[model samples]
Target: MLMRYVMSSLRISLLMMIVLGLGYNLLVTGFAQTVMPERANGSLILNDQAEVVGSRLIGQENRDQAFFQNRVSSIEYNGASGSPNYAPSNPDMLKRTSDAVKEWHTQNPDVQIGSLPLDLITNSGSGLDPHISPAAAEVQIPRISKLTGISPSKLKLLVNKHTEGRELGFLGEPAVNVLELNLELKSLMPE
Candidate 1:
């Protein structure tokens, strides 16, 4: 007799839970998934037009000669490697930074960089940062000027144009997005 009462209550509770869950999904997430933006899927698509070769949201291991370089990445934008699992004393990062520093020195033999930018050496917290510090962007002006033949002053202007300040002007340092900047560069240059 007591077992029947418990079983009936249990059945009622289960029915209520199923009804509430279905109602919430249909009224909220189902509509959101249909009406809202889902650009990640589109961003992953490479149509050989807007996207040079691969997904623009992802980073390439090698820098293209014609394009401005952004931060270095260990993951190479592979979904498996995702965010770089960096140990503070990770030998691989140190070695990679060492080689990059050597190459940077080779490329800009005269410029006194003082110390390497952390962003230049480290993969961002999110692999798709899409922006770098203004200082980092500024430092590359000389090298970019050489590659693009756009005067450093002009490049500085472009960087300034693209640079975005922090929220309310006090949260974070200014950042410039490489992909966006590169697109602007393409427009400025004739095919």
Candidate 2:
């Protein structure tokens, strides 16, 4: 009787593992692939040559004066997606923020530090966040305009064009995808 009970328990465990572990994963993957193939495949952005340039989902370092910069990334935008987890009082965090502020002042002498967006000086919880608040993008417009010779008005229009409204109309604040914005900006550059 004990032998029979043990065998029954083993059989149930195997059945559950096959059904829940393997079957569930297959079902979800199939549904996602069929329903949203582009998203399932990483939402890759392509250039005119159809070459994969980057993903709409990941952030990258953009230091060129001609382009709007992204938020400070603790992980250097390697796509690892993490924060430094520093406390508000941590000296290291304070130093990093100070350094970022100094760099911003150096790079954007025209914009006052008081008006600078917090996102420009702080790292996002996910270091790979590709979007920045619309305000953040706007704050950099003057610098980008001066460097690229694009009119400030035209750059503002571009920022507005690239800005996305909150998810489902109310979930999050408006944000501009830096990668997409930069790509469009590149086209507007003098050739």
Candidate 3:
């Protein structure tokens, strides 16, 4: 009787493993691939030559004067890590924020700068945020306009064009995907 009970338990466990582990995963994968193949296979951005430049899910650092920058990344734009747990009173955090502010000032010397945008100076929680708040992009308009020779009005229009609304209406604030915005800026560059 005990032997029969053990065998039955083994059979049940094996069946559950096969169904839940293998079958469930395959079903989800198949559904995702059929429904949204591009997203399923990583939303890769391609250039005109069909070369994959980057993934839409990852943030990239754009230091070029002509390109709009993303938020300060604690992981240096790497997605492998989450936000740092540094307290506001921490010297390292204070120093980093101070340095970012100074760098922004240096970059926008000619513009009439006011209070710096928080998004520009602080790292996002994931440390891999590809999007920046609209206000953050707005503040950088002067620098990008000067560097690209694109008129401020046109640049503002481009920002608006690339800006994405909150998810499903009121979930999150509007944000501009920095990678997408930079790609658009590249297209607008004088050849």
- TM-score for every candidate vs. truth? 0.69, 0.93, 0.91
Q: Top model by lDDT, which number?
A: 2
Give the per-residue lDDT digits (tens) of candidate 3, residues 35-56: 9999999999998899998888
Q: Which sections of candidate 2 miss by over 4 Å?
A: none
The candidate maximizing TM-score is: 2
70-139, model 1: which lDDT tens digit per residue? 7766666555445657676888767887887877777666556575566865677766556678777777
The residue-level lDDT of candidate 1 at 53 comes to 42
What lDDT would candidate 1 get against the real structure? 0.70
Arrange candidates by TM-score, descending: 2, 3, 1
Clashes of each: 0, 0, 0
lDDT of 2 by residue, 1-191 (tens): 99999999999999999999999999999999999999999999999899998999999898788898999999998768799899989999999999999999999999999999999999889998899999999999888988889999999999999999989999989999999999999999989
Which structure is stronger by lDDT: 1 or 3?
3
Error of 2 at 18 (Å): 1.9
lDDT, ranked from best to worst: 2, 3, 1
lDDT (0-100) at residue 112 of candidate 2? Answer: 97
Shift in Å, residue 74, candidate 1 = 1.7
Candidate 3 residue spans exceeding 4 A from truth: 111-113
In candidate 3 the C-alpha lDDT for residue 50 amounts to: 94
